[model samples]
Target: MTVLNGKGVLDGIAIGKIVFYQRKGQEAVKRHVENTEEELRRYQDAKEQEAADLKKLYEKALHEAGEKSAKIFEIHQMILEDIDFCDAITDTIKSERVNAEYAVKKACDTYIQTISAIDDPYLKERAADIRDISQKLIGILTNSESDTFTSEEPVIIAADDLTPSETVQLDKSKILAFITINGSVNSHTAILARSMNIPAVVAVGEELGLKYNGNNAIVDGASGRIYIAPDAETVRLFSERREAKKAEQEQLHSLKGKKSVTMDGKEINIYANIGRPEDVEAVLRNDAEGIGLFRSEFLYLGRETYPTEEEQFQAYRSVAENMQGKQVIIRTLDIGADKQADYFEMPKEANPAMGCRAIRICLTRQDIFKTQLRALYRASAFGNIAIMFPMIISVGEVRAIKQIIHAVQLELSGEGAAYNPETKLGIMVETPAAALISDELAKEVDFFSIGTNDLTQYTLAIDRQNPSLEHFYDAHHKAVLTLIRITAENAHKNGIFVGICGELGADLSLTETFLRMGIDELSVSAPCVLPLRKKVMETRMDR
Candidate 1:
């Protein structure tokens, strides 16, 4: 029996035979083509055929899945027809006098190398898309059949990683779960698996590839472990656990539409943290009261350039309108540290976590800040929209942000644009400095949402992302708890409300403590809303 550990992105249990999926290696031959024009024509013809095939896949996916899942094929089609991609192939053909297949491979490798070198995990995963499209084009040019997986029964798929296109083309009924040697929780494969309610474990390490194919495997997604040919006793234990989990899920689902009020009649708001407009659907499905933290940087990440003000407005407006009057707190760009945008032209700081990021970037680059402010104000007209600034540490930052909002409102008024003049403003109390002076800062904003993730890291003086420091990174440390207590007390004293919108907020063990601390709300991931709500309803606080 073999047990492998990995990071689980979704929760579930699956017992099935292992199915190893290997991408067929495509070798590009450097054969000289006398007719260069003929090679270009072949490239064009291959693109046309690939587009047609993708269109059919898109329609089929749309019928089986929703529009969001089907959008993967649409992105593939766009990539195949991208002018830069086409130019690279033609340029290679003209310069190297090679066959269409070789030129396409060369062009794809250049882009794949470039994208793979990026520091951001989300953008780095996009390299897989380039490779997937390149293989399709090569298959068409060489008259080779595209690879497909056909399973007689449901199986746990094991791969190095899966591209968005590859994931969409999967036979959902035959997929028990997915285990990948290389992938991030933010990868497209993980996102698709979550939407499909499938268990997935990624970054299982290269040692997992050594497991024999077709081995009877049990995947425990909740614990991020996989057992291969487990003992009879282990299997029985996991089977019972799985059944118990199913029961828990049913109970949680029944809690939907129920108010999150404690036994003592203390009301607590349960909200969701979303990164994109599409995530609002999950938020609604989880019956969250509102969106607590909308990471607006998602629109800026994985893109070639900054999103225009109009584009930002449309995205914000969509989330606002769909919420149907529920409050949506959108955090301005929190891009630096672990989340890096190449186009932002940010310098390579040794300690980016404490360096210029978040509100610092917006404050320095008012042009970019003003553009986002303009969009937020414009979208406020749609519904209850609130703006929140992240990584704030002082009264000066809050005042500057208010000034920018004031200027944006004036600009909108001058243009005769409709906007809500009463949009609420808030700030994230992450730093210890912010917590110490919460009373003074609370007077500047409407509410306070403690970002416990950064607060714990900052207070403990540990890098949360460093696995070596995992032992020292304690989210429930007394220092962190004291900071939260102080922040909440000050905010309440200043006639403002306080909530937690971090990973710590979803911790069931700390939920009672937060309630006792007078926390007004808990904003967690959509999946945690029902479970958190259940905890809230069962909680009691003594006066």
Candidate 2:
């Protein structure tokens, strides 16, 4: 029996046969083609086929995964349609008199190497997207099947790493779990696995030999361990634990309609953080009271142009109407740092996290900000909707945002567009400066939603994205807790409600502390709502 340790990104248990997944290597043949015109024709045909395949994948992903995730396929489609990329391939084939496959391989390798050499980690990661699209095109040109998982029985897929496009194409029914030799906990693969409710363990060292392929394996995602050919006793124990987990999930589901009230009758609002309107279905399934953080930046991603006001309005309105009057807090564009869009043409910053991002971008680029505000206002008339600004640090920023809201409201009134005049306005208290002066900032906004993810990173002076610095990135540090306490106290004193809408809010261990801090609400991912509700119901502040 072999026991391999890894970092588990999702919590679940699965026992299945191992299916080693290795992407077919693209060997560039440098043979000269006699007919360059025919080679170009071949390349164009393969490109068209790749586009059609991506379109089908996009539609399928839209139905199965949601629009936000489906955008990955859209990004792939855009890559295929990139004029520069296509031109480069055509020029290489014509000028070099090379076969279509060889020309494409050279062009893709150049771009991939250039992107991988970038200093910014986010941009460097984009190389994977390029690789995925290149693989598809090359596979079509070579008349070979692209990388895929096909099995009649359930299996645990083992891979080096999965691109976002590859991850979405997986057949979930046949995939019992995923074990990757290398991956990040914050990668799209991990996020998608969690959303699909699939068990996944990543960063497991590559020493687990390929000889063990097709071996029986048990993946304990909660413990970040994979057991291969386990002893009979170990299998029995794991089977019992799996049963217990199933029962626990059933119990949590049974609490769907129950209010999140503590034993002392302290009612806490349990909300969900959503990336797009399609996530509202998960929010409803988990029985969240409302949406605390609607990451409104998703509409701007994976596109060459900014989304129109009408498009944004339709997206926001769908969530509001679907929620049926439940409070939907839509955060304005929080791009510029880890999240970016090429069309924005943002200037590179030495340190983007603290640079011109979030509220700064909105304040400086009021045109973009106003467009989103107009959409949110237009959607407010459909159902309950509130606007929340992100990365706010001072009272001045809050006032500036309100001024923009006022202008948007005036514009809507002039156009005779119906909107809720009483839509609630709020700001995310993420930085230490914001938390320290929460009392002053609280007076300007209707509510305070503490973004602990950034607050903790800023407080600890750690880049949470860096895996090497992860040990220094303590979310429950004394300073972070004190900041939360201070922000909660100040917000309550100013007669405003405060809530946590970060990863820390979903920590069941911290539930008691938050309840004692008088946090009015706790918002997390959809899957966490029921678990948090269960914790809230079991908590006793009096004790």
Candidate 3:
């Protein structure tokens, strides 16, 4: 028996025979070609075909894994159509006088190397995207098709690493779980695994490889361990755990439609955070009281240009209408930092986390900000919708945002568009500055939603995206909790509600602390709504 440790990005357990997934393309051999134009034409044709393939994958992913997970394919499509990326392949073909396959391989390798060299882990993971598209293109050029799992029953899949495209292409029904020798929790592949509710462990190293194919394995995602050829006792224990996990999930369904209130009658609103309108289904299925954080930036990502007013309105309206009068708090575009769109043409920042992002971008580019505000207000008539600004630091920023909102309101009225003038306004208390001045800032907005992900990073002066610094990135640091408590206190004093909308909001251990802090709401991922509700109901205050 072998026990291999890794980082588990999802929680679950799987027991099955292990199958090493072999990626489908053959190595592209360097070959000289006489007609450069012909080679370039081949590359273009293959690129277009790959783009179409990605579109299909996008549609499939949308149906299977919601919009957030499906957006990876759209990003891949954008990457495929990127002018710089296309020019690289074409330039290599013309300058090197090489076959299309060889030119593509070289161009992809160069780009991958360049991206991998970046100190930023998020950008570093993007190298896998380039490699994914290149592999598909080369396979098309070489008349090779990607492989699919053909096992009669579900089996655990092991791979060195999986690209977003490759991960989506997998047959979910045939996969019991998947383990990768190399990956990150922030990687798109890991995100997909979590969205699909599949057990996944990453960064397991190369020791568990092809040699162990067909071996019985137990993947304990909660423990980040893979037991290869597990002994009888280990298998028995895992089987019991798996059954208990399944029963627990089934039991959570009973919590649906129940109010997220404490036994001591301290009621708190439990909301869900979403990326797009299509995610509303999950929000509703989980029976969240409302949406505390609607990440509006996703609508701008994976595209070549800004989403127009009508496009933005339709999306916001869809979610608002679907919620059926449930409160939906939409955070304005929080672009920059880890979440980036090349079309924005944002300048490179030495430290983008503290750089121009969220409210900063909207303020600098009022045209963009106003367009979104108009859409949000117009959509407000459909159902309950509120606008929240992120990464705010001062009272001046809030005043400026309100002024812009006033202008949007006047314009909508003049244009005879039906909109709710009573729409609530809120700010994300994500920075220390905002927390310190929560008293003054609370007077400017209708509510405060603490974005603890950035709060913790900024407070600790740590990069949350860096896996190496996971030990130092303490979400429960006294400073962070104090900030939250301060923000909550100031917000309540100023007659405004405060809630958490970051990853920390879902931490069950902090539920009691938050309840004790007089937190009015807790918004987390859809899957967390019920569990959190259960915890809230079972919780008793030590008064």
Q: Which candidate has the top score in TM-score? A: 3
TM of each candidate vs. truth: 0.73, 0.84, 0.89
Identify the runs in model 1 with alpha carbons over 4 angstroms from their true place. Answer: 1-11, 28-147, 159-173, 179-197, 200-241
Residues 273-305, candidate 1: write the lDDT tens digits. 887788788899999999999989867755569
Superposed model 2: Cα runs more than 4 Å off = 1-9, 22-27, 33-134, 140-143, 159-163, 180-191, 202-215, 223-225, 229-233
**Poorest stretch of ten by lDDT in candidate 1:** 60-69
lDDT (CA) per prediction: 0.87, 0.87, 0.89
lDDT of 2 by residue, 114-184 (tens): 88776754555566678878878888888886676789998999888887768778888899998998887
Give me candidate 2's TM-score against the actual structure.
0.84
lDDT of 1: 0.87
- Quote the RMSD, in angstroms, for model 3: 3.2
Off by over 4 Å in 3: 1-9, 44-91, 107-130, 181-188, 202-212, 224-236
Candidate 1 residue pairs in backbone clash: none
Candidate 3 displacement at residue 207 in angstroms: 5.6
Pick out the ten consecutive residues of candidate 2 with the lowest summed lDDT.
Answer: 118-127
